[model samples]
Target: MRAEDEPDLVRVSLAADAVFAGAGVELPPDDPRTLLAHADRVLVATASDGRPCGLAATVAIDGHPHLEQIAVDPAHGRRGVGSALLAAVRAEAAARGHGRITLTTFRDLPWNGPWYTARGFAPLPRPEWGPELVRLWEAEAGIRVRPRIVMAGRPG
Candidate 1:
């Protein structure tokens, strides 16, 4: 991702949040600039017009790759953009010698939990959470009201 792609990725993230809002789920406020600043890698998926339509950002946690955020413009939903972006992240993580990828998401959401499950992720037992993952879960406690779960998958 280029410096110029930040704004478009931010736009896509916020637009995708609207989908959760529409479902009566209120997500914690997030700053895209902060997210990008800490991201180890940002993968962008562009539309046919060459405009960004989705993105996946990753960070390292306990020597493994963790997906910090993934968002797709609702306009481009169900067109494989999200899947492709995830695949790219997984490949990158694998190439970097990371054994697995981890993430947290609303457990009940069709697109949040089930979607990843379909793609090979499984709920991570809390007992397996590392110190960093525990800190992350705690950090999000007050900010997010919806039920969330951590999941992990071997990066293929």
Candidate 2:
């Protein structure tokens, strides 16, 4: 994605996530910018017409990779965009020699937790999260107002 795509990417991510989840779970204004700033890699999937359809970001932490955000435009949901973006993240992690990738999502949210679980991410005990990840979850807890489940997956 080009620098010009940042606003639209953030818009699509927030809008779609709100639709899929709910208003209270929406991303804050600086959240996408922060993710893009810290991520070692960012992958975006576009539709046949060249519109942004999905996005994912990955950052390295203590020799492991963390999948930061994965968002799919509601209009493009159930297509291959989400799966393809996640595959890109996994491939990028493996190429960087990371042993595993971890992420957190709302435990009871159908689209949030179940989607990742179906793609091979397994539930991880909150106690097992590294310091950086723990901090992230804590920050999210402040914003989301809903309990989240942490999950991790090893490269296959």
Residue pairs in candidate 1 whose N, alpha carbon or C atoms collide under 3 angstroms: none
Candidates in order: C-alpha RMSD to true structure: 1.0, 2.2
Measured by TM-score, the strongest candidate is: 1
Q: Model 1 — TM-score against the truth?
A: 0.96
Indicate the residue-level lDDT of 43 in model 2: 84
**Model 1 CA lDDT for position 41:** 88
Model 2 C-alpha lDDT per residue in residues 23-142, reported as the tens digit of each score: 456544455776777778778888888877778987776568888788888888878788888888888777777788898887777777888888898998877888888788777765
lDDT of candidate 1 over 65-144, digit per residue (tens): 99998899999999999999899998888888888999999888999989999999999999998999999988879645
Model 1 clash count equals 0
**Model 2: how far residue 137 lies from native, Å:** 2.0
Candidate 2 yields a Cα-based lDDT of: 0.77
What ranges in model 1 sit over 4 Å off? none
Q: What's the number of clashes in each of the models?
A: 0, 0
